[model samples]
Target: MQNLTQAIKHLIIINVIMFVAPMLLNMDLTNLFALHFPKNQHFGIWQYVTHMFMHGGFYHILFNMYALWAFGSPLEHMWGRNKFLFFYFSAGIGAGVIYTLVNYYQFNGIYDQLINLGVSAADIQNVLDTGSYNESIITLPNETMREFYSLYHTPAVGASGAIYGILVAFAMQFPNAKLALIFFPVPIAAKYFIPIMIAADLFFGVTKYSVGNIAHFAHIGGAVIGFLIAWYWRKNQFTFR
Candidate 1:
């Protein structure tokens, strides 16, 4: 196991404190720190960065912190603290923006459909605010309406997006490195393993077949942003260390 690099060590500490402090204080910081929809009342600009440090549960934080230490440490070591920190925050902020844009696309699609069906702006806002809509007045599918409501109400919290960025950077740095998943113990090269993971997120994001309250687009966004920046750096032979 590699020793935790400076940036990764500090990041893990901050994430742990964010995760634990709320519980200890019996404080619900979700509204303040978690990433909410742009139209949501609790939405804040800072959430783009803060949400990366907030996690949903024990396993959520565990996996994210472990991945940060495992994948990010090497990147930090190679790029130095300043460059790695910049890339990390850039990818994370990019993830949040992409996630929001995708949600807005879906939400607006449904919203336009409702408007075409004679739903008024007031009624739509009411529905978003209260999660209540008169069935007789709106003939949209239950699943579609449910998704619309959820898009507005659900808040995203986790470092998975940023961790995904690190994973992409790691794979680019060491394509031939062996990697394995807890479920699939067979070791696979990072090049193959990383793409498969990103593909899985894309599939789940598009199909909405994900089992949990996962922000798959955020993962894909992080990977996409990470790839772009990493590719640019490599193409230019950029090195900070």
Candidate 2:
């Protein structure tokens, strides 16, 4: 590995810039980088790719970059720069598409439910188009109305899905590689870690559906796309070498 330097520098820099600059300036980089409605009044269409580069907080970016550097560099070396870049971007874009699917279900569901409860189409349109839920438009009982309003109001942002893709890649490629938890130092292979994490995401996603501000579905979406792409490569026996 003498000539093979860490190939994740650019990924690290992008994450750092996205995470640090925004927090330092007290700006919401997630909104700018996050993919919004096609006619999103908040951000441009370019945000689909830009959002993959942005992260929510220090821990968010740090863990992702760490995983990218840890597992992605090995894959890049095996796949070459061009191929690796292709996979990285493909996984990220795939994540965005899946997230959009989930958001569609959520936004439309909320809109329909609100309209049924006497909310106006104008207010529903605002939420669908801008990710905002108008409190004044809610006509249901107070507790249910408050809960409904909270569900569609906040923005979902991060690179965790794409990062989770990398984790999947790592698990598949090096199923035998032993990974140890720092705090709870049980040695488990990469293969075991990926599935366990996916299961936990699913459980939490279903069980805590009402809890505000978590994009558990997005995590599942990313993993599914990553698995499909990786499986195709493996099935075709296509090696970058």
Candidate 3:
């Protein structure tokens, strides 16, 4: 495994600075880290880059930092600072793009369904205008309102997608690595563990089985991008071994 390098230090510093800048400048930095539904609402296209720096809170950054320390140090040392930085941002952006695409299709699907159901043209316009389902169907019953709320207002915040990408990278390069789930005595090989985790996310995303603001698709997006990246690298003659 590789050791922590300057790139990791630089990333940690940049993230901390961005996280603190919001408070210092009297602006909300939270939106910079988490992608919102309304395209025009964010700082700009640059938020896609800065968003990786802003985290929701302590535990949010904590988990990401820990994962970086665990999986990224090796990657950084192996790839060097410049390459590592490129890989990190690429995965981050890839996650964001894929997430938006999925949301777009689903939102359009709902809009089409509502149109067929004869929701007033005004109501449909409001939903599309504000990007909020609740705002769209204020006249609906309580049961329907519950469903609308589930559709929007759940902004995903965190660096887990990129971190999950790093996890996939590490698992691919070191399939024999022994890792234990939190509080579990058993150690699982990286090869088996990572795939199982990805499969679980896909299953849950498909079923919408869990009730929470988990960006399961984003996680899968990051992992898929990471896998593709590793594949591309190897095909072009880059290999950790």
Candidate 4:
């Protein structure tokens, strides 16, 4: 692997500090930085950007920081530091927006249904406040009720969305580049690997698979924005050198 570029190294350092600071201080940083439902009391405008730097666990940060160094350095080398940072944040913010929009869609479905079934706004607020709802007040099916209950309280965290954007940009810039997967132990070309990963996220997002704690739509959102930016740059023959 190539040595880390200045921007990628700085990002990794910042993320490490963010991850370690909360743990060392015995502080719960999730409520303050993780992206939350807009209606949630913890929701704040700053979280749109901050959430990109927050991770849920050690492995979470490990994978993301590794990807940032592995994939992002090349982009920074090609696009220069300023453009690279712009693309990174743009994709991240775009991911947050799209993730929120999708959450709103699913949330509204349950919200409208609950209202029609005579569930009160106060009761709904209780569920958001405390991830548990009174079954007596909610007439929806058990599964549907659980879905709504989880959606309102769960906050999205981590840099996976922006990392997905980086992966997309990497594939665009080096389609023929060969990459290997640890579990698969097979060297696959970037053109093949990247699309397959995106397709998997799409499938999981639409089907709501048992994949734990992943914001699939956020990955899609980042890729979508990243693709647009990459395509535009490629189309215009944009280059730093």
- Highest TM-score: give the candidate number: 1
Model 2: residues >4 Å from true position, as ranges?
A: 1-7, 23-28, 37-40, 123-153, 209-212
C-alpha lDDT of candidate 1 relative to the true structure: 0.93
Residue pairs with backbone atoms closer than 3 Å in model 1 (clashes) = none
TM-score, candidate number 3: 0.83
Mark the 10 consecutive residues where model 2 has the least summed lDDT: 145-154
> Candidate 2 lDDT, tens digit per residue, 31-80?
56676654345656677678778766677777777778777887787777
> How accurate locally is residue 190 in candidate 1, as Cα lDDT from 0 to 100?
99
- In angstroms, give how far residue 63 of model 3 lies from its true place: 0.6
Candidate lDDT (C-alpha), each: 0.93, 0.70, 0.73, 0.89
The list of candidate 4 runs beyond 4 A from truth reads: 132-137, 239-241
Q: Sum up the clashes in candidate 1.
A: 0
Model 1: CA > 4 A from native: none
lDDT of 4 by residue, 7-101 (tens): 88888999999999999999999999999999878899999999999998999999999999989989998998888998899999999999999
Instruction: Write model 1 residue lDDT over 59-130, tens digit each, in one string.
Output: 999999988888898889889998899899989999999999999999999999999999999999999888
Model 3 C-alpha lDDT per residue in residues 73-187, reported as the tens digit of each score: 9888787777777778788878877876787677656656677777876876666456465534454455444444344444566667787788898998899999888877599
RMSD of each: 0.9, 3.6, 3.6, 1.5
Order the numbered candidates by TM-score, best leading. 1, 4, 3, 2
